[model samples]
Target chain A: MSTTAIPTNTKWWNGGRSPFNASYGKVMMWYFLMSDAFTFGAFLISYATLRFSLNDWVDANHVFNAFPFFGHQDLPLAFVSLMTFILIFSSVTMVLAVHEGHKMNRKGVENYMILTILGGIAFLSCQAWEWTHLLTGEHFALTKSGAIEMLNTTVSHNPWGHRISGEVLTNALRHTSPDVLRSMILEHNHSATLASLKDLNANELISKIDLNEVYVGRSGPAAFGSYFFGITGFHGFHVFSGVVINIVMLAKTRLGHFEQRGHYEMIEKAGLYWHFVDLVWVFVFLCFYLI
Target chain B: MSDNVMTAAELHMPHDTSAGTGRIWKIFRLLSVITIIELALGFGLARHWYGEPELHHTAILFVKGTMCILSLAKAFYIVSVFMHLGDEIRNLMMTIVVPLCLFIWFITAFLWDGNSWKNLKNTNAGSKPDQTEQVVPAVIEKGAKE
Candidate 1:
């Protein structure tokens, strides 16, 4: 019998270590991502369940219809599309960085990492703009008796619309001279006059205007603000953290740390985290914006 | 050779099997195309091109389904290609994927349960369910009576 005895002390035969044939660090990153995914999943599913049970939830289309600097042109889904593209492009840069890292191309890795970091910063800026616009914009709440009430919305109560009621116009008319008001309306080519703003009821006022030009308040399910802030804010926090990590990674890359290590596994690991962040955003986009 | 030699150029050369820059760019283009399509659908379906847009139950359900599918596809591409999960060993892929599937199932179950909670709260505030009528009998009828 020429059969050799099976080796008992070999590295591969060690109990329960690297059973998945991946590096320890890589497997650990996967585990962390899995847990983080659960946290996000719980938040989104709760949002959906609550939204479904509510009789009068705000339509996402109406709430997220604004674009940057376009000044309310009814440009629905445009800014978010741009935001989504930015994140996706950042993810591409991340993948390219990892690829360059695999080739042991130090300069390529550094360049791509820098691009990825810039993309992250851009996405964060866009998100900041969206949040600022949301918090500072005009809002209105529909009252029980069919009259629209202007609301200075805060974190607790955001009815998700811009309804400048007849009272507001009336107040504007009172504040400004007739010539100035006439010039303002003429400059904007608005059909409203100071006389018309004086005696109109809320319904009559709403009827006289084009709903697209004015912000029409949706029937908000009471928990809309809570869910919107909670889920999107949590996701935004992740994006911010991811950007910080990417900056750190970029610094390490430029310092020749990965090059000295003779492997770009660190870049690969960071790329995994970045891609996971993007993945979470996909779900968030669907839950908050699309569905 | 000095034992302090830890420089990258001194390290043993390993085989580099990563795809070329061109291939990476190609994948990027594909991802961009898919995302643009999703954006078109999102904008097109929501806008009132005609008159007042009605939110029919079936229409809402269809749009929701389409959005979910597209989002999942985007996630799949990013994970499998960009994260290189698909290129990993089968055991490794299973280690990540199986747990994720279970997590998704848990979310669905919990969400359904939450909807039930909302329904119960809305219909009968502070009223306890009749255990004999709604709970025990159901358990017994499901063949746990023995």
Candidate 2:
């Protein structure tokens, strides 16, 4: 217990500083990001397995065809491309903020932080639009009987690019009242007649329907809806938290908090988190939208 | 305590007058150009503009491979430059990077396992008849009028 009691010649442990030469907080943040990366990686791998498991899956090009105000155009990958640019641009601004922190320029830090915050908000809004478009829009499936089924997706069911079984339709039909069935068909623009309804013979009635023509409510796999919502929703939550972290950092900067600490390493740490969020988006873009 | 107090200027960090501003702008331009190139390739070749039909499977795979590589490149730039990971001490770099490499390995292993599961489900002899066939009826068997 005495200082220098044993004079060891080994120059092993350094004192009073981190061996990594980085702040403890920054290194911890990296560790957290790495673990978070694994979570995302697992989700994506699950998506791939299930997607490849199916004989046919919804193509990214078809699934994400909608754009803001354009209303279901074939502008494949356009909106996501813009979102990618915006996120990357925000990463640039974050780096600038960190650089300004290094220079002790409060104004530069504030300005770049503001830009980064705006970019984060814009990205979030775009994602909101994307989610709303996906969940609320019309989806179609080609039934096993060669009849098109007009479908709406819930978290539990997605009909896009998957075939609905005749049994599923027949079973659903058995439970549905005739009035409800007729109204559902008319609502979704399926040209079913009361004569077909009165027949009570689904196979005979479905035979009268045209091939390649759409009908209403035949269940398809829930995998697509589950994965899409699960993965993107997770990423969306990360973006939301990143924005919140940035806003807090911005408030502290405005309150002269970092100046009181004699360095802006706090800002640098926040910048690290922001950059990590943007980095995750790049992968999400590739997995969900592009590839 | 007074001797322990190090001034910001003494840290020798970049100042307002340094060439760091130019470096930041250069990185911004590089990122933008790479993104634009990725977008163009994705739009033109993958989507098949100019009267071309959809790409062949191999061609589509090639495009996807290119996009993945480009995305990794973008991630590298953002992490190294924006996060300043490249400028950090080697131990610090490894502290972040080595674990991430394991993360990638985890994904690859799971993806390969998942693919095997898919292949197993698809080809195994004892499996139930392929659902693809039963999913949609080829022809509706009309019953006698009841």
Candidate 3:
């Protein structure tokens, strides 16, 4: 190939055109997402590593069984599936916003962006409820001294452990402190006054308590709660930031910034980020909630 | 100003808005279906409503594997269609994709090492004498005293 035979247009790296045939901003966005992927990948892989090394783990189904408005019903994986759909729907809206942006339809963009933002906020609210529930909702666990104690999941603690057999629970119940017994009885019978319940001896309280209502288990590995909070908290932070970005994008769109600039590429960039958040949730859902 | 300009290749790239929107919804439906299937499998296996009780362990592993594959499928659709990565130039796609292959090694190495560590801990360093119970030599003790 002589120099004269070479086509100038074919020299992609010759500096006047983009080798990727994409805007610099879009390329940078993709690179940022790629790096973000690695960050999440490392976190999730480390989670898997810890999980693989452990002899026992908290079953996700048991931990995530609660659903809003269902009280104490055992609806495993129900709430998270709803959250997943909310996120997926929001992703659809975001893509629609981008599509409308392509057509220069400001109204369509505004509507879809609003929907997308609402979806994000709704998902965040669900996460908040979930975190609060896990942190506050009490469960029975067998302590090291063979006493049954009421505890909730926190970053440092996990209450979803091996179920205490009926016999073990009966034995452990006798050894439990009066304070724990009162609380456990109160949990089962909300109508009873704390002072009255506290006045009752351990044996009397144990007699009043129904063994079937009591769900006692051994204390689970602490890492379960830590990983659960760490990874989900990180993902929630991403969703929060994505919402902030979308709000900024929405404001810019409303201000006609893109119109004046002659393109809606900024929205496209934001859409890429928003979609990436949804993409990460797919894996997060799989890793944390499903399996 | 140069950054805002579309290149020759980009100019030639198809912009089929109508078809594109249709495909987006199609992919959305596909994603939702896949998610639903994953959740069904997850819920069913978790509740012991599917598979034989004798194969419970294998059933869980199988379901987990299926969910992982389905999650990858969802990721692919999100990246390819929703993010418009499929429309990007081949070189661009390769740039984004090739580096992701590292995850295979990253996950395998970490998990393999983790499992090995578990084995090591469980087997007490593969048949070595219990370090805690090893007796200290009296000669060393005497030398330290001196």
Model 3, C-alpha of B95: deviation from truth (Å): 0.6
- Find the 10 residues in a row with the least total lDDT in model 1 chain A: A1-10
Worst 10 residues of 1 chain B by lDDT: B137-146
**TM-score ranking of the models:** 3, 2, 1
For candidate 1, write residues B87-119 as lDDT tens digits.
765667888888888866776787677667645
Model 2: CAPRI class: acceptable
**What are the lDDT scores of the predictions, listed in order?**
0.67, 0.68, 0.82
C-alpha lDDT of residue A30 in model 3:
98
| Steric clash pairs (candidate 3) | none
Tens digit per residue, CA lDDT, model 2, B1-146: 56643443333233333545677777778878877777777676545631232325556667678888888898888888777777765666887777677756676776677666555654543266675354223212221000
Which of 1 and 3 is the better model by TM-score?
A: 3
lDDT of 3 by residue, B81-128 (tens): 899888776778999999999999999999898787655654557454
TM-score of 2: 0.77
Best by TM-score: 3
As a whole number from 0 to 100, the lDDT of residue A205 in candidate 3 is 91
lDDT by residue for model 2 over A76-116, one digit each (tens)? 78888889889888988998888888778899999999999
- Candidate order by DockQ, decreasing, is 2, 3, 1
DockQ of 2: 0.29
Expressed as tens digits, the lDDT of each residue in A164-253 for candidate 3 is 666777899999988888877777787888878766788999997878876787777788888889999999999999999999999999
Instruction: Please provide, for model 1 over A18-105, each residue's C-alpha lDDT reduced to its tens digit, 9 standing for 90 to 100.
Output: 4455567778899999999989988888887776544335556677888887886777778888888898889998998887776778
By the DockQ metric, which is better: model 1 or model 3? 3
